[model samples]
Target: MKGRQIILDQINGREAAALMVDGQLDDLLVEGDAPRPGTIYRAVADRPVKGQGGMFLKTPDGNVFLRQVKGLAPGDVMLVQVTGYAEPGKAIPVTQKVLFKSRYVIVTPDAPGINVSRSIHEEDERDRILEVAHEVSREEGVGLILRSACEGADRDEIAEDIANMLDLAEQVLADAEGAAEKLLDGDGPHLAAWRDWSEPAEVVTEAGSFDTHGVLDALEDAQGSRVSLESGVSLFVEPTRALVAVDVNTGGDTSPAAGTKANFAAARALPRALRVRGLGGQVVLDLAPMPKKDRRGFESALRSAFKRDPIDTTLVGWTPLGHFELQRKKARQELREVLK
Candidate 1:
């Protein structure tokens, strides 16, 4: 493999060099010119200072710099990773835009469906929401759901959703300033249910405990079979997000399936397993096989079954080495937390 190197240093600690192989981090070697920029790092150091669209820039002093990237604010926190560039020059930085979007509600008119909505882009509306949230709390008591999840939501619900988030925003500020330890964050059980429903796993919360039923019932009412709770976990499989991966262990305790028919049953259920587990991305299902040709047939059947799920799913068929692969989209982060 081919590689390159970049040096990074800590102000008080020793220096180290990052090794890159094929554009990937391969190793870190000690002893190099990893001098710390020996400078203060500030995200929001300066305000626009009396202009609507003034720009910002980072000026380097000697080999040291105070980075000013377009679209970056003075107070923003940055996670900097050094990447190798072809051109020569020590530590030339190129800015990349990263949008951190939070979930929001979308509202629509004409649908009798409860709580219909479209997701909101943080860039598009967070300021307005924050401002109004303060106002709403001062006058009318309410909360808001920032609405990124409502990308395709209905019309009538949008206003109400905004109102809800605004209400929450004001409370967040008040609790912080008042130093109220008991102040809870503004998330509702309904939103909490959506968080569970957005996961790519078959969510299993303890059966009769924690109002899991209410969560499941509300999700079902709003999203239909896209959400379900059984065996102490609730399962939500949606197509709007990225794919998740699931690993089913035959648990050294249960003996493996005995025959071809049984093996076929397991293979046949791969799609459902993917759906139930919300295993998206490039799924490589390595189950006990039936036979050579049977594997292909089972994959075909599984592919067909995945169509019934509301989420978008595609089976890449079996690998030459025997493993089922699938590609799918799922909600963000929920699946990772659930699986963990």
Candidate 2:
């Protein structure tokens, strides 16, 4: 369990796009931008089309949503920060931005009647905290995330973050106005994800070229764990939705009483293996299902086969098909430590 770095961005919605790690959102990036974010709502006097509000339309990129309607008005600013990555090459998928949805108090007087009516989703509230972050990102009329960094944080800390965000947003506005184009907010989702993962694990790279020191520091600060790196651990990946198969190499733990011994061992190690491998949900262990009769029968033989790691085996009783039923935790991604 090592902390890694990830990136983050505000994409189609207010949510930051990212992949779910341990049921947590990591890696985010903003995908598209309106042609204009703070232009005044000047109604066309002579011949205006119906429903046209002179609003700046952030051009839609691909179907991947990294955009959101923050209801910004002229002079109103939106703040963004560029975060880093969960692991090298583990870029946040722009299409999955919806995974990080949140609701905030939005003030859009120009919209006439649009108010913050929807209640916040539990998942968002549970994951992120609203701190003085609101102030740092204030532009009069905009919505933004009170990132997980603010969760349980002191009021002073929140306020400081908010101020920082506001300052950053103002700078972005200045650049956009002068450029008259879609201004890129140097900070995006990628960096955010990187910072989040830097917690709980150390980020190691094969080559020393991709050094993101600032991202690692920010992640270490946001989270209270040290990130480190390891070497010589080879990772193999196999993409399969089929049932996961774990084979234990006991190198001949088998003896005259090996059947019962192996079964007991597998029952003990099985759980740990499942957790380490990040396997879960409905798992078909394919172990020997029947009773062993003094640990030397067919049951004993089956147990010996998987006993090396047996803690994970929860004999969910037996199944109608005479097959043994067991459940393992589901992992969001390929388990990097299954073999180890």
Off by over 4 Å in 2: 1-195, 198-206, 209-243, 247-251, 255-283, 288-340
lDDT of 1: 0.35
Q: All candidates' TM-scores?
A: 0.30, 0.28
| Model 2 worst lDDT run, 10 consecutive residues | 92-101
**Across residues 199-227, which tens digit of lDDT does each residue of candidate 1 receive?**
22222234332132232222123222232
In model 1, where is the ten-residue run with the lowest total lDDT?
35-44
Error of 2 at 56 (Å): 29
lDDT of candidates 1 onward, in order: 0.35, 0.33
Candidate achieving the largest TM-score: 1
Candidate 2 local lDDT, 1-340, one digit each (tens): 1234333322224323233233222322233332111222111112212353322222221111122333434433232211211121322112101111221222222232222223334555433444234334445544454444444446665565445544544454444332123234232334433433323333333222122223323322223211111221111212235555433222343445543444444544444334333344455533422244543454444455445431234435445654445543222222332111
